[model samples]
Target: MEDAAMEDGETNKDSEVAPALIAVHPTQNSVAVAVGSDLRVFDLLGGCAVSLVNDSDGSLHKDSIRAIRYGANGKLSVSAGDDKLVKIWSTKSWRCISSVEVIESLLTLLAVKR
Candidate 1:
């Protein structure tokens, strides 16, 4: 399958690639996307407008994002991928807060609170 992946060490660019997976923020009405080796988010506050993320550095992920999910009533978003890492981001800034490495391929994931 063809995937539109950005060049190495590259961050945001035109989304020419088809997304591998998608998750909706339950209360935020936003969407999280797993596109190629990147994870992008679109905040639907008004229309379908979106902006590039991880603009500060090309540190979003090293491989294609495999899964994404929202939890805590849309306050937090989680993403995982072939990189064997699960990243958690805050909804307020869309900034990554933590990273946890695993030993398995992250083909699917979920984030929830008890």
Candidate 2:
């Protein structure tokens, strides 16, 4: 079965902060988790935090990541945050492709294939 972050308390902050959001790739064996200002990709079966979120500079969201979703055959991922930013990332390279600044604070985001 497909899954996402099945393990509990994998991160010390798991208890300190509740998961803001969770998104399982529609066709992939991975899960995206949002905690505080950080976003982590986890192995569905292994249930371990992966490095898909890591970057040479730093985190993707400046504030808490409030929403996450997969688009178009799980090839694209989107994240929105309290920082008032919406970001799109490519699942292939895990690199950011574009970003949009929202005038109003963002609560959630849903990306659909066109």
Candidate 3:
């Protein structure tokens, strides 16, 4: 498989590199798109990019994000991928509330534990 990143630590510039995953809020008020190791979110109501609090090393995901989902009536967002990390985000604050590291390959289906 081809790596998404380029030599400059940025994603590939190919126009054909489509989003790896997309998640829409239950209420249709927001959308999240995962491309390579980056995650882009938009607020439908404001018609602007949603500001997400990055608590990590200035990167969204260390590896390509394979799965993204919104649950709990769009209050929570979950993202996981080759990094073997499952991250839960609070939609309200757009901040990562928790993260779990797994030893095995990531599972696309994730359920938010209240």
Candidate No. with top TM-score: 3
User: Scored by Cα lDDT, where does model 3 land?
Assistant: 0.78
lDDT of 2 by residue, 1-114 (tens): 223355543554445543578888888789888878888888878978776643434668887787888896888889888788888888887877788788876566565775
Work out the TM-score per prediction: 0.69, 0.71, 0.74
Q: Rank the candidates by lDDT, best first.
A: 3, 2, 1
Q: What is the lDDT of residue 80 in candidate 2?
A: 84
Q: Lowest lDDT 10-mer window, candidate 3?
A: 7-16
- Local distance difference test scores for all models: 0.72, 0.76, 0.78
lDDT of 3 by residue, 3-108 (tens): 5345434433433243478788887678998888788899888999988786865566787777888886888899887788888888889998887888867566
Among the numbered candidates, top lDDT falls to: 3
Q: What are the root-mean-square deviations of the candidates from the true structure over C-alphas?
A: 8.6, 11.6, 6.7
Residue 53 of model 1 has an lDDT of 47
Off-target runs (Cα >4 Å) in candidate 3 are: 1-19
